[model samples]
Structures are given as C-alpha cells and as structure tokens.
Target: MIGSILGDIAGSVYEFHNIKTKEFPFLTPQKGYTDDSILTLATADWLLHGGDCATYYFRYATRYPCPLGGFGGRFREWLRQGQQTGQLRPYGSCGNGSAMRVGPVGWAFRTEEETLKAARISAACTHNHPEGIKGAQATALCIFLARDGKSKEDIKNTVEAKFDYDLNFTCDGIRDTYQWDATCQGTVPQAIRAFLDGTDFEDCIRTAISLGGDSDTLACITGSIAEAFYGIPPALHAQAMHYLPTHFQQIVAEFEEKYGPKIH
Candidate 1:
C-alpha cells in the first residue's frame, strides 16, 4: 500500500538519472507516482471488490495512461490491443512490472498459499512468463512472511527455497555492475537484496534506489516488504500521501484498514 506507493514516488525521479550512492534526498519536488503506484492501486481495488483482475488492470491503465514513468512498451501494446478488441489477454511478458505492482496481493491474503495464488493471478494477467509469475509470488510471499512476524533470515531462506531467487548477494556488492535491467529475473532478486540490507522502511527504499537499476520498481518491491517488516513512520506516510490522487489515497485507507500489517 502506502509503503509501495512511497517507494514508487520517491524513486520516480531517480529511475532515469540513477544515483548509485545511498546519500540522496528521499523525495524531490519533481517526484510523483508512476505506473507502479497506479497498478498497485488497481490490484488493491481488485482485492477489495472481487472481479476479474485483468479488467481492473485494463481499467486502471486506461484511466491513467500517461503516468509519470509511463507503462512498459509491451504493456502499452497490451493496453492498445485490449482497448481495440475488448480482449485483455496476457502478453507473456517477463518484466519487473508484475513484481512492481504486486504489493497489495501480499496484504490482502491471509495464508501463504492464498497470497501466492493471488500474486500468480496478478502477474499472469500480463506477465504470464514463468519468471514473471515467480517474481510476483516471491515478492508477495516476502511481504506475507514479514508481516507474519518471520525473522529476516527466515524470509530470505523461504523466498530462496520457494522461488529459486538467490538472496545471497548484497546491494552494495552489485551496485557498480547493475545497470538498467527491466526484467523480472534481473530486478526481483536485487530488490529482495535491498530489503534484506535495510534497517527500516525508509532505509529499504534508499537501499533499493542505490542499486540504480529500474529504481522505482526496485524500491517499490523493497518498500512493500519493508512496510510489512518495520511499518511506516507516520510523518513519512503523511508526506508521501500528498503525491497520490484522491481515489488512490482512499483505496490505501480502506485497504490498510482491512488488511494492512499490524506492526508491533
């Protein structure tokens, strides 16, 4: 929810002009929410009101076609086709878009199995590629585990064992070599590593951005998990909500009220 949206907005400005160092402003005057936030809200809406997840995705994309960072090229085409033919089909994409927008599925479900199923449904709408679905499930499961009071070590091991994503590396170790990779295989593990390195919610977003590869998506993924693990600071939450739309803010409020983590 707000955690994922905060990450998306905070990292929006840095996606193109990537900063490798963690020493940077958390959010700039130029920052705004991207397709990540839009789709995440779409996911939340879908979870709140039961319907075809694809329909929610298409509606959201149609409503906010020109977001700050814009939708991925393949997803753009998917939207185009869905608009023309009234058939919203999966595009077999393996992009990080699936993982970036999957935070709500983590919070909305109670069991690990249900979370994974919802995550799969979310990703398979467009990112039907095996890696894409795996990325979403892995990310959602991390949030589930974190919110369930699992230890960091437990989360790392569970995600690694379940999805085959290596959480063994650190963000600092890969900072120099990591480039702008938009793929799920390249992005999701790194995002997880960023979360693993964080001390708190804000720190997680910073660490994900410092990796400098698809910053918003990375931070979005990291922030979702971090929120479940550490909860958001009240001040930061209020500040970030100012950037979101009225509808999105409403969705966040409703979703958080019903399913958000009860951080201790």
Candidate 2:
C-alpha cells in the first residue's frame, strides 16, 4: 500500500510530460499524493470497516469530494451522482484508475483465488469494464506472487501465461520510443518489465517512472510488484507515509488493524 502511494506521488508531476528515459529526477520535495492515494486509502478503509465496498466508496468520495489532487471528471461525477441518489451504479472506465488504487486487495487475501476475487470486487466498485477489472486483478496477482517470494523470472512467466498481456516490449529497447497512452494495453506490460528489471523497491519505481508514459500508473504497477518482491524499505516506507494526509493515515492504520501489519 505504501508502494502504491509513493509511486502515485513520485510520478504525479510526470503524468503529462511522458519522459521515456530512466534518467529523470525522483523524490523531489515538490511531489505529492494524488487521487490514487485517496481512493486506495478509501478502499482500505472499506475493507477495514467490514462494510460494503460501494457504500464506503460513495461515503468517502462524497465526504472528500475534491481530494488533494483531483480525480478524473467521470469519477468525480459518479461520486456526485451516487451521493445525491444513494445508488452505487457501475460505470465503464478502462482507465488506470482501477490499477492505480488496487494495492490493498493484494494484502487482504491469503491465496491467489482470494486475491483475484478481492481485486475484482474492489475494481468493480467503480470500473466495471473487463479490461479495467483484469488490469486490477493482474496487478494484485503480481503483488501476491511477489509477496509470496516468487523469483522475478517465475513471476514474469506466471503473469504472462495467466494474464495474456503482451510482455514483449522491453524498456531497454524503448529508450527512444515515445508515446502518450494511459490505457492498460499501453502501460501494464511495460510496467511489469520495469519491475522485473529493478533490483529493489526504489529501483522498481525509478525504472517505471523512467519509462515515462503514464508515469503514475506505471509506477503504481511497478510499485505493487516491487513491494511484493523486495517489500518497502523502512526509510522509504516512512517517507512515503509522510506524503499522505491525516485522513489517509487513519485509513492506513485501519487497514493494518484489519489486515495484519501490511506483511512487509
């Protein structure tokens, strides 16, 4: 969960710039958390409270309508509508929104089947599209495998076989390939590669942001994998927590209370 938040905050500034190199500044003091952190915290809160996901989603989103960093317009609209109507209807969003905020699902479940089920449930609360749900599930699965101490090669092979995503794109080969796409098809696979290439948690995040396109989502994807593999370093983990607001800290505490110390 701290991995996801750090990824979001670190990559926040570069979400639009799309730099395609591994040689960019990281951990600047100016960086801050975004909607990714807010929603992730909300998801954790829901799970901790033992409440319905949709109910907590609407509740938190309504109470904190304008997060420190804004949400996508459609999601904001959904929150408004759900608040007014008290109905949590599904919307079709294939954006990285699902992938960016799905870290807690990986921690809540002990088995792969349970992890996938929780991931689907968490993603379906807002992003009902199949790809959206799949992206979330795939990320959660990667984190689960990483947390379970799978080798990078084994993790890559397993994810490639089960998820059917194109993992052919290599970051080393794409030093000059620049594109501005945030779709799951465009980002998730490469993000996985970045994790595979990383030596540790910070390396994974730096590698993802260096790839440049949709940096935050890529970082989120890589962060989840890195956390699973290396766990969060104590110093970086402490620093990541500071980027979050007080409300989000409460949510993290609640998550730890329910889900057992985040395991890392």
Candidate 3:
C-alpha cells in the first residue's frame, strides 16, 4: 500500500509532463498522493474492518472527494451520488481507476485464487466492466506472483494468457512513442513492463513514470509489483506514510498489522 502511495506522490507532477526518461526528480516535497492512493487506502480499510465495499468507497470518497487534479468528471459525480444515496450500483467504469487502487487486494489474500476473488470484489464496487475487472485481477495476480518470487517471464505469461491484453509493448517502445492514456488497456501493460525492466522497487516506479502515460496510474501499478518483488524501502515507506491523513494512516496501519508487513 505504501508502494502505491509513494508511486502516486512521485508521479503526480509528471502526469501531464510526459517525460520519457527515468532521470527525473523523485519523491519531491511538492509531490502528494492522488485518488489512486486514497482509494487503495480505502480498500485496505474496508478489508480490515470487515466493512462492505459500498460503505468503504462512500466514506473515503466523501471524506477526500476528488483532489485538485484527480479522477474524471463522471467518477467524481459517482462518488458524490454514492455518498448522498448511500448506494453504489455498478457504473461500468472502464477507466484505469480499478487497476490503480487494487494493490491492497493483492496483499490481503494469501493465494492466487483468493487474490483474484478479492480483486473482483474490489473492482465490482466501482468498475463493473469486464475489461476493467480483468485489469484489476491481472494486476493483483502479478503482485501475488512477484511476492512468491516468480520470474518476470512467469508473471507475463500467466497474465497475458489469462487476460485478453496484448503485452507486446517494450519499455524502449514506450519511451519512443508516448501519449497521455488513462484507460486500463492502454496503461496497465506498460506499467507491468516497467516493473519487469526495473532493477529495484524505486527503479520500477521511475520506469513507469518515465513511460509518460497516465503517470499516476502507471506508477501505482508498478509500485504494487515492486512492493511484492523488492519491498518498499524503509525511508521511502515512512515518507509515503506522511502523505495520508491521520484517519487513512490509522486504517492502513491496522491493515498492515493484520496482514503483516506489505512485503516480506
């Protein structure tokens, strides 16, 4: 979870800048988390307290709303409506929203099946589209594999075979051809590849942010994978924790205590 938060914070400023190299400032004082971190913390909070999905999303979203440069218009409106009515019906959002916020599901479950189940539940709370749901599931599964010390080839093969996504894009290619894409299909695979090419956790995030498309979400996805592989460094983890509100910190700590450290 801290990995995801750190990624969001580190990538926040670069969302529109679209840099294509990994040689940029990271974890600057000006950086802060976006809706990706908020929703991930919310999901972890819900899982910890046995809170229902709708209640978790409603409470957190109402508390945070959309920060200055956060979610799309429809999603912001959906959060408002869900808070007002205390109901969260499927809105069929195919945005990378589901993928960006699913790190906790990967960590909370012990096995691949459990990971997939948790991912489905987490995605269904907001993103009901099949592609959206599959993106979350694929990301969770990748995290699980990374946690288990699976090789990059294994993770790629499993995810590519299971999900209907084309994993042909290389990091070099992403660096060559860049655009600001926020959709699940457009961003998730590139983020995963960033992690695969990374030398360490921070490198993974740097790689993702450098890919230059939906920077925050790409970093979120890469961070989740990095957490499973190398774990969040203690200094970076502490720094990331400071970005959250007190309530969110408490919730994330509770989940961490219950599930053990985010990375072994």
Candidate 4:
C-alpha cells in the first residue's frame, strides 16, 4: 500500500541518524524507499497476480537489490544463497521485516481468519519463527479491524488478547530509553501503540518514528494500519506517489482500486 511506502521513505533518513523528536518534516525527499517498501510491493504483487510468495519476494528484491537501507543481513544472505541455489526456504527469522510488508494482506482479505492466514503465509517464506508469524498477523489484523470500523480500543484488545503483545505503554514512555531494535516483538507492539496513540494518519507515522527504534519499519507498520483507519489525506497520498518507481506506483494504484479501504 502507498501508506506503507510513504512511511518507509519518510523514515529512511532517520533509521541511522535517529531523531527523538516529532518536530521533523513529515516526508523526506532525499531518501527513497527501502527493503521495507520493496518487500511490501512484492507482497502486493503476489496477492494481485497469484504466485509463490517467495518467488515474488526474490524477484522484486533482486530487481531492486540495493534499496535505501539495503536488505537486513540475513535477508541479504538469503538473496545471495537463493541466487546461487535457485531455491528459497524459511530462515526462521523473527525480524520486523515480516510485519513491515504485510499491509496488502490486511486489505485483500475480508475475514479475520483469511487475513491471519494470508499474513502467516506471507511471513512463512522467510520469517517462519512464531514471533515472526505473530507480528505479521497482528499488523494485518489491525488493518483489517480498522477498515472494518472497529474502535481503537477494540483493535487494541483484540491484538493483545490474541497475539499476547502488551500494548499498554505509550510511545513517550519508551522514547527516552528505546534504542534500535529490529525484532518483531520489540517493534510491532510499539508500532501498534503508536497507531493507538495517534490523532490521524500522519500523526501515527510520526509517533512511530519518534519512538526512535527501527524507524522505517516501525513507521511502515503504523502507517499501514493508520491508513486503514483514518485514510490518507489526498495531498499526502499524491505526494507519496512521487517517491515510488513507476512500476511500484502502478501496483499501488491497481491494488488500491481493487481493494483499498474507503478514504475518510
């Protein structure tokens, strides 16, 4: 979804040079999309066309092999190994990458069961760890619930009860001490809390980035859910399109036309 890509681009610059404050510009033009955006597109493409999830991930990743932050170390090695072996399998990773790229699944499926199943399938390609699958399912289900007109408290309770992620903390509560964390357990809960704490679509992203840990991935997850809830502002959506490649934009447009949540 465009929301996910927008967050990736917006937070790309701050991933390494983290800014703890939320006063920064909402969108950054200097840095483009990253592995988060690329894999998200891969997920969308897989859902649109119908194919092996791993193949799409490999194809998109290889096509844009070097993104802003580059692929995570293990994913980079997975690419290397896949290139040589022509085969891909689960790596048992619990990284936040699984949750970051699961936006489309949330929209494409109608039921909670379907959404969770698709999320699991998408994540099992590489992030087959229990936490990895749980993260993706939690994120996708949030989007599903948001678009279904569920209240924030309902969404929070469902995620906490089902996924066992404690969403009781605020972003400010963790900001001062939160350091860089790339795992699903650390990142997904905070991203959800950011969405719960947000005032709107952009606010959710800023809050996620302001948490100052795995900025792009955090914001990417939050943005996906926020877009489902608040809907992206027309100007923000159009501005974000400029940062995506032609092919990526095309997929976003097509997917949105078919399955996008109604804008608020």
Instruction: Tell me the TM-score of each prediction against the true structure.
Output: 0.98, 0.92, 0.95, 0.98
Ranking under lDDT, best-scoring first?
4, 1, 3, 2
**Reference-based TM-score, model 2:** 0.92
Q: RMSD per prediction, one decimal? A: 1.0, 2.0, 1.6, 0.8
Q: Which pairs of residues collide in candidate 2?
A: 146-228
Tens digits of per-residue lDDT, candidate 1, 1-264, equal 788988998899998999999898887889999999999999999999999999999999999989997888999999999989999999899999999999998888789999999999999989999999999999999999988989999999998898888788888888999999999999999999999999988898999999997999999999999998999888888888899889988998898888864333
How many backbone clashes can be found in candidate 1?
Answer: 0
Error of 4 at 148 (Å): 0.4
Residue 124 alpha-carbon offset, candidate 3, angstroms: 1.3
Query: 106-193 in candidate 4: lDDT tens per residue?
Result: 9998799999999999999999999999999999999999989999999999999999999999988989999998999989999999
Error of 1 at 73 (Å): 0.4
Looking at model 1, residue 159 earns an lDDT score of: 88
User: What is the lDDT of every predicted structure here?
Assistant: 0.91, 0.78, 0.83, 0.92
104: Cα error in model 2, Å: 0.8
Off by over 4 Å in 2: 257-264
**Residue 202 Cα positional deviation in candidate 4, in Å, after optimal superposition:** 0.7
Model 2 / residue 216 / CA error / Å: 1.4
